[model samples]
Target: MKIKIPTHEDYQSHDGLHYYQLWNSIGDEWLCPACGRSKFQIMKWTQRFPNTPHSFMGWVAALHKHHDHSIGFFEPGQTRFPETLICGQCNSTDGVVKRMLNLPSNFSFSPQEMRTFIQATPHGKHKINYDQALEIFNLRATNKNGIPKVY
Candidate 1:
């Protein structure tokens, strides 16, 4: 299947297959279609947001490995780039809401998933308490679900 990737130009996801642009870019890292949104701002986390677990590690590595796209927040006062998602065009709170709902179905796996997937064997089972598990979903500056509900 020919999957369209993000370039310097903007492209939208058709059907169920949406390409998400990277929040940070590291020196010539391949840009896919998702990276070309109008709201795409090249921002980095101060200390890696809890939301991105595996990606945090990878992003750190990219910063060290590459000369460009060093992992740091976008400098204050610049043209607001694409990929923000909260902007007028592609305002998607669902993505943030889904971030909090980290079930296997939700795509945002909790720490439990890491423990279960990495520590547990196929025969072993790691049971998670739904109430306690939801605590992992708390997003800073946003609602508990992690999505910005009110503008």
Candidate 2:
């Protein structure tokens, strides 16, 4: 199934912000805009301060799902590119896969670092493996902030 691709005019009319608001406001369940799938997921990444491991990431994507349509709060000051909107099923395609091929390797967090992170926040107490932390960290690192770049 194909997703509705917004036109340039759509972006201009809203000054590039309305679409996100509209998507977030959908009350009833809607099909995935990318694959027409009924199932949708919410993804989130957090940036923690080294000193306290507190989420220094400010209010961000708080009102809406991640650009990927995953439901979760995103790091403040991070931007979501158009590529993020692609569903997981579609992400493996040749051209789309290449877009993420250049993503940097996950940041390595030492055991000590993990401990420090866990100690800083209430939610940190939950068991989170290194891979999981690394994935979120990477997403936080790569995400762009403000209006998504139109390509």
Candidate 3:
């Protein structure tokens, strides 16, 4: 298959697949904010997201661009950057948590939230408790006005 990986300058001016592709293009030692897993770490997974079958080759080493779907948040002055780089498992778990919790379609867990939840709960392979995750999801923010949310 000839998948066209987007270059840093060739990506679109919006978010979504392109953002993740851009991150993959600029591959580095990015750590998943949730599990602290490295991009190059040799992990195993059969899927990246819902309904998506993932191969255990290059796909396992790919990092995902995790961000709040509703907020359009990112590093200040950066358009293509996501809030954080997360491993496929971590990012996939977020989707499972959101779906099971019935969170708003646009609701996305921030990196801090994912980190706390993963640490506090015994989650593996995307199995997490709704009530516990919900509580952490609503945790009070420490960021003050005029301060950008930093990981």
Candidate 4:
């Protein structure tokens, strides 16, 4: 069977994603667009989850329907859909990074936008790490307004 590469349209979720469709569209091999990590990699990483009795289940549970939080919050179990699938870690890190960099709350890096920020090195695939985000912040900070703490 020919693999049908999913368009951006396919990933937009309003109600929620169908896991079966994800298995079919991207298969077992697709990487998370935000950090370029694969599901298996995320699963292995989740094995060492420091907190929670359901640690082993973290892998499946980590697959989050990451959406625009600026859109407003939904009540628990209220079927908040996705902009795309990102591991729980990346989704949380987005918050951390925004705070660290003082980016606007609504500001977010889209998958393709995020791709530009990641650094590819010979040391295998890594997340769009904090260092990368820091570098970007430094460049923009120096060029635009100049950070107070930074020279």
Candidate 5:
């Protein structure tokens, strides 16, 4: 099954700002347009089954169901697609900005580093899934902030 994700232009303009506002109102990373805080009232969506209605609906039925999900809280050109974070205060789109704040020490091993590590270790084997190299590189460990520090 193919899930349709909006294209880059679907969410952002040439200047890197959000062109749509609807996502900012409901998504977790969106700041409050009025309060400028990363908090908002959680809205629940009721899923309905198509044709033959039932409380526990099948995926196929859910897909065919016609449900109105629009809350009308935001306007067009108010949000950007592919954005993980939105500044609700000014309706500014900050995609991946928060994630790049810090790199944890564990991500230091690049793909080349992994290859070298595996080759140098005794009893090591080179494979796409380098379990042995991972141990030597310590790529699994991360900082408290969860940013990739070592890459």
Candidate 6:
């Protein structure tokens, strides 16, 4: 079955500082259970905010490895037990919700799917500095039954 991944545009964009604040709010560290990697990255875009100079228009938080990336998908307003965890490396799938219980261990998003879901947003569309829009992806410090934890 296909999973719904959040596009950059799906991120909250109330203000230019919103994405950065969101990223920081998520926490400051993340770890990949399969590879024990701790490096994560975030991307954000800026656009005019009605009368205001500019605000964050898009954002994405992803786990970064040497040759691949992954993102977490959880229920809206729910932080524990992600619906699915898609890992680009090894194309592995970890079912985090009951509906995904039947997903194959090897199920993974394709290159095109990654583009459409994770990397389709264009950059440099506004005047925010790259540093201002980007940040380190953070994971929370709690443990769910199946979801990975950030430390």
Residue 31 of model 2: what lDDT?
41
lDDT values of the candidates? 0.26, 0.31, 0.53, 0.50, 0.27, 0.30
Candidate 2 C-alpha lDDT tens digits along 1-151: 2323334343233321234554455432544343333222211123434468464742111122223322232433433333233222233221222233443222222222233222121111123344444454454445466343221
Better of 4 and 5 by TM-score: 4
Writing each residue's lDDT as its tens digit, candidate 4 over 37-68 gives 66444432124335767555222314555776
Which scores better on lDDT, 1 or 3? 3
User: Which residue runs of candidate 5 sit more than 4 Å off their true CA positions?
Assistant: 1-106, 117-126, 139-151
Q: Which of 5 and 6 is ahead in lDDT? A: 6
Superposition error at 85 for model 4 (Å): 1.5
Off by over 4 Å in 4: 1-26, 46-61, 69-82, 119-151
lDDT of 1 by residue, 36-105 (tens): 2222222211233456664342111111111111112223233223322221111122233344454222
Clashing pairs in 4: none
TM-score of 4: 0.46
For model 5, what is the error of residue 2's alpha carbon versus the real structure, in angstroms, after optimal superposition?
30
- lDDT: the better of candidates 1 and 6: 6
Model 6 spans with C-alpha error above 4 angstroms? 1-16, 19-21, 31-40, 50-151
- The candidate that wins on lDDT is 3
- Give, for candidate 6, the lowest lDDT window spanning 10 residues: 132-141
RMSD in angstroms, candidate 6? 16.5
Which of the predicted structures, 2 or 6, would earn the higher lDDT when compared with the native?
2
Q: Could you estimate the TM-score for every candidate? A: 0.20, 0.20, 0.52, 0.46, 0.15, 0.19
What is the C-alpha local distance difference test score of candidate 2? 0.31
